[model samples]
Target: MAYSHVSKKNGVAYYLHARVTPTANGTRTMYFFAKEVKAGDDVTKALDEVPAGYIVVESDATGLPLLKKG
Candidate 1:
């Protein structure tokens, strides 16, 4: 199952997704969350857990989830 985060304020479930892109410096992996999984999203790229050294936080105003490097 996709990693999920429940918004404390809104109580909405958000599923985590990841995408990898090639850059001049190197490959970069981007992480995000959505209410539903997209069709083109790779199953392998969808994270099953919070990434190591990272923490999830909520926006104070919007209550949207965010990933923070810990």
Candidate 2:
């Protein structure tokens, strides 16, 4: 598994940095609340409380990093 602190771009969370475990396997990246998240659990919900120009990274990326989106 990996973890990143991504800010929202358009409507999705984008990774600025992450720590990949090199053995993680999943379809969706897991998001965590920086203030209330616990270990061994994954958050699959989208966040809606971000500031107009800022937000914490939602989760660890699930696959090859994306450079852009459609």
Best by TM-score: 1
How does each model score on TM-score? 0.85, 0.17
Q: What lDDT does each candidate get?
A: 0.84, 0.34
- Candidate 2, overall lDDT? 0.34
Which residue runs does candidate 1 get wrong by more than 4 Å? 40-44
Q: Summarize candidate 1's per-residue lDDT along 4-67 as a digit string, tens digits.
A: 9999989999888888888999888888988886556443266789999999999999888999
- Per-residue error for 6 in candidate 1, Å, reads 0.7
lDDT of 1: 0.84
10 residues in a row with least lDDT, candidate 2: 13-22
Alpha-carbon RMSD to native, per candidate: 2.1, 12.2
Off by over 4 Å in 2: 1-26, 41-70
Over 1-62, each residue of candidate 2 has an lDDT whose tens digit, in order, gives 22333444334333232222333464443333332223432423334333244444332454
Q: Pick the candidate with the highest lDDT.
A: 1
